[model samples]
Every structure is written in structure tokens, then in C-alpha cells.
Target: MIKGIYETHIQVSNLEDAIQFYTQVLGLTIGQLDEARRIAFLYMPGGNKTSMLGLWEQTHDLQTRHFAFHCDKDFILHGATEFLQQNNRHPYNFLNDRSSQPMVFCWMPALAIYFDDPDGNQLEFLALLGGESRADLGVLSYADWLRHTTTA
Candidate 1:
């Protein structure tokens, strides 16, 4: 039986750039690099050396992908946007309202912000929130989520 995701792979235009972005900016640790294969393996922070990500260089007809990183609530709420902006990454919510604010998926009750890598692959920072599922609410700003949580 499957327990959880241990690793995921994505195609990148440049392996070295992708490695730098994931390691220097996102703080992942390099697990291995295969120069002959143009692939690099990286370990997620605090993943207990289990979770991994693979980047494969593809020059022609490259297809981008999306993925999310688990993060702390405090970091997602108070620091994610600023940290991303400081690193020249533009954070946006699911609504695409042109704001760097995190949004809450009422169903999962999780807060998340989206950004793109150099190759236009969507990346997300997500933190699960503590509350009852509100599937009817869909996606909304963190402020709206807070308001509804208090009033309900």
C-alpha cells in the first residue's frame, strides 16, 4: 500500500539553474548530480532524508509542472510573501487578484500561496489550517477565512 509521496520529478530548461533555485533560494540540499544524465536530485528540508525532488534538463518541447511544499503556518502567514519577494519571486493567491497574499482552501482548510520557477513551473507554499471543512466557501483570502472562522 502506498503511504505518501517520497519523490517527484520535473523537467527544467537548465539543470544548473534549477539546482541553484531549489538549493540557494528554496534551501533544498543536493543529494546527487549526474552530469552524464543531466539530472539532479535534491532533498527537501526537514524531510528526514526521505523526501526528494528530481530535476531533469530538457531543452526541446519541455513541459512544465506544478508542486507544493509543506510549510509552517507562521511562515506561510507572516513570512512567505516577504521572503519570496525578497528573493525576487512574485507570490500570488489562487484567485490571481494581483496580490501577494495567501489564500485558504476552505475544503482542506489550508493556506497557500503560489509562485512560478524560472521555467514557469508553478510552485506553492502550503500550510494546513485548523478548522472544520467549509467546502461551500471555495477559495478566499486569509482575511476572509479568518472572518468566517470567527463568525461561524
Candidate 2:
């Protein structure tokens, strides 16, 4: 049985640029590179070899993908937006409301913020919240999630 994701691959327009972005910008460590095949594998920080990301270069008819990275609750709530902004990334929410704020998915009771990679691939930083599930609330700002959880 599958316990968790071990690896995932995405098509990138340029392998080198993608590697640099994931390494220098996102702080992933390079695991291996295949120059002939124009592919690279990267290891997530503190992943301890459990997680890997593959980037394959493809210039024609490329398809983008989405993925989420697990983050600490404090970082997600306090610093994720600012970190993204400082790195010139635009943070968005599931609602696409144009505000750069993390939103809470009441069903999962998880907070998350979304942004796009250079290839327009959607990526998310997410952290689970401690609270009773409130699926009826759908998705809302973190502040609202806090208020409702505390009062209810």
C-alpha cells in the first residue's frame, strides 16, 4: 500500500532554469541530473531522501501541473505570504479573490496559499490547522477561520 508520495515529475520548458528555480529560489537540493535526457531530480529540503521532484525538459505541447509542499503552521500563517512576495511570487487563494492571504479549507481544516511557478504550474504551501472540521463553511480567510473556531 502507498503510504505517501515518493516522487512526482513535471515538464519544464527549460531544465536548467527549472533546476535553478527549484534550487536557488525554492532551496531544493539537486539529487541527480541527466544531461543527455534533459532531466533533473531534486530533493526537498529536510525530506531525508523520502521525497523527490523530477523536472523534464519539453518545449512542445508541454503540460503544466500542480503540487503542494507541507509547511509549518506558523510559517504558513505568519511568513509564507511575505516570503513569496519577497521572492517576487504572487500568493493567491483557492477562491482566486486577488488577495495575497492564506485561506482555510474547512473540511480539511488546513491553511494554504497558492502561487504559480515560472511555467505557470500551480504550487501550494499548506499546513494543517487544529480545529473541528467545518465543511459547511467551505473556504474562507484564516482570520475568519480563527474567529469561528474560537467562538464555536
Candidate 3:
């Protein structure tokens, strides 16, 4: 079996804002400040803590766009609660086909939520359901999507 993800790096529009959201809002531990490299890595929950995220200060427009977090439902609500209480702002807002509530959304077998950083980059948190895991989840082929929509 695979050990875990080494890390996930994301370029941020503003490093300061990203830092605030992660450290203050989400309560993630911070690492060494490498201002010269314009990069910072954030860790996740687990034994080995192999899952980590990296934020890079963006000097230009972001190239790769989407980023996500896999967390528990209670953990997400707790984190989102703290985020709103701290910043007076909700993270997840439905860009399209979204509801008008904060920290609440549905997607497949995963309960998903979303929000943005100061630079307007989209962020997501997905709470996997019981007996469900991302291991079985993966890129969908066009044929699969077509079959899924059929009224059989």
C-alpha cells in the first residue's frame, strides 16, 4: 500500500492572507518562514501527517487552480465555525448550483464545503461518508459520466 502524499503545493495570490486563513482560521501549525523562496508548507491531521499543503507567494496570475482538503464532517463544521467567528466571513459560497448556507453542501458520497482565500482562490473541504473513501474515487471518463446520467 502507498504510504501517503508527500505534500501538495499551491501558489497563492497573497502569502500573508493565505497564512492567516491557515494558521489563524484553520489552526494549522506553521513551519519555517522562507521569505526568500516565497513558499510555506502546511501539515494535516493523521499519524504520520504525510498530508501537507504548501503555499507559494504568487508574483503573477495562478496557473494551476483547484485545491481541496479531505476532512471529517464535524471537523469541517468546527473549522468553518472558527473561521467565521474569527474573520466574520464564511468560506464556502456556491459559485453555481450552490446553496445559500455556510459550511453545508452535498456532493456524491462526500459532504463538501468551499471558501476562498484573500486572493480569490477557491478552496474546498470534503468530508467522506461512512464506508466511503477517496481511494475508490477518481477521475471520471466521459463514458462513465454519460452512463451515470442515463435514466435506466
- Using lDDT as the measure, the top candidate is 1
lDDT of 3 at 46: 46
In angstroms, how far off is 62's CA in candidate 2?
A: 1.2
Relative to the true structure, how large is the alpha-carbon lDDT of every model? 0.94, 0.92, 0.60
| TM-score-better candidate, 1 vs 2 | 1
Listed in order, each prediction's TM-score against the native is 0.96, 0.95, 0.65
lDDT of 1: 0.94
Distance from true location, Cα of 47 in model 1, Å:
5.7
Clashes of each: 0, 0, 2
Better TM-score candidate (2, 3): 2
Stretches of candidate 2 exceeding 4 Å from the true structure: none
Lowest summed lDDT across 10 adjacent residues in model 3 is found at 98-107
State the lDDT of candidate 2 residue by residue for 121-142, as single tens digits: 9999999988789999999898
**What's the lDDT for candidate 2?**
0.92
